[model samples]
Target: GRRIRKGAKMTYTTTYHSPLGIITLASDGEYLTGLWFNDQKYFGSTLTHNSIDKELPIFIQTKAWLDIYFNGEIPTFLPPLRYNTTVFREMVWNILLTIPYGTVITYKDIAQEIAKQTGQKSMSAQAIGGAVGHNPISLIIPCHRVVGTSGSLTGYAGGLNRKNELLQREKVNMTNLFVPSKKNL
Candidate 1:
């Protein structure tokens, strides 16, 4: 559900073999436009143009970032990213970047931050969840670090199993976090 810039017709894509699964990385020749698990929900949602299998400099940088990350270490650098989505989603994704490598935050926490930023009495946690679920750049933006209000591991677009794996990879304190029940999920 992202709007591609008019006349920006060409895009580039490359595949990353993550330990969990295959990930597809997309770029607009310079900035990273999207990264998603091959089988994940909303995969390639931001790539509305003709994408060729080309290796660009951004892809190389991103692969390095992911290389460090998949090695169970914090990546020392962030590859340049280009967001092609609504302003609200962009704001939510930026907040997600503030979540620490080995820590977790909740949808309610993000909503509160958005409220504080927008001068609103409150923002909807469900809305935040929606934005997080549709995040084009996944691991780098840290959408997998978000949990439910009750600390339940919920609503991961790349699958809850992958979310749990990522959190464990980061050595997060899993004592309190839990998978939600069927109805909750």
Candidate 2:
């Protein structure tokens, strides 16, 4: 298979009408590159010159997945993701796939899981948080499932309020969900 070139920048943006509001979907040629809430503040500067064919298969798949998700169905479609990030960030993103629908995990939990997988005890939660913050694909990667150490809502690139709404829409009752105080490493 021909891989999309690393650092070969491209972008396209479109608005999705959802219960939350108009979500702007951005993409590189090969993958979904961004999902932003209409009122999100930090996303303005993140826009770039990368332009892709909106009619590409990956873009179409992403739109279909979003349609299923918003229509009260579990999103079963997982499209290929093309992200430009560090090796560690890629590893962290792969780990995100193991988190099932309607479930949530804390940043600290992610750190411990990655540490166990790599046998690197020094890998900090802060580092994992950085990788998560850099997630280019949004709902498909389910970055909204991650929370703070206190089991409270944390900052989401898409906006914390949107994150809460996503969790709620998925029927994840954060109030009753168990968050361990001790790291699982």
Best model per lDDT:
1
- Per-model TM-score versus the true fold: 0.94, 0.80
Candidate 2 structure quality by residue, lDDT tens digits, 1-185: 97877876668777778788877777665567676666764563346865543566666787788899988789766877666667888889888877898889889999998889888865788888888877766778888899888776666777767887889889997785442334431
User: Which ten contiguous residues of candidate 2 have the minimum total lDDT?
Assistant: 176-185
Root-mean-square deviation of each candidate, in angstroms? Answer: 3.7, 5.1
Model 1 score (lDDT): 0.92
Candidate 2: regions farther than 4 A off: 1-8, 41-47, 50-53, 176-185
What's the TM for model 2?
Answer: 0.80
Candidate 1 C-alpha lDDT tens digits along 36-62: 999999999978657799988899999
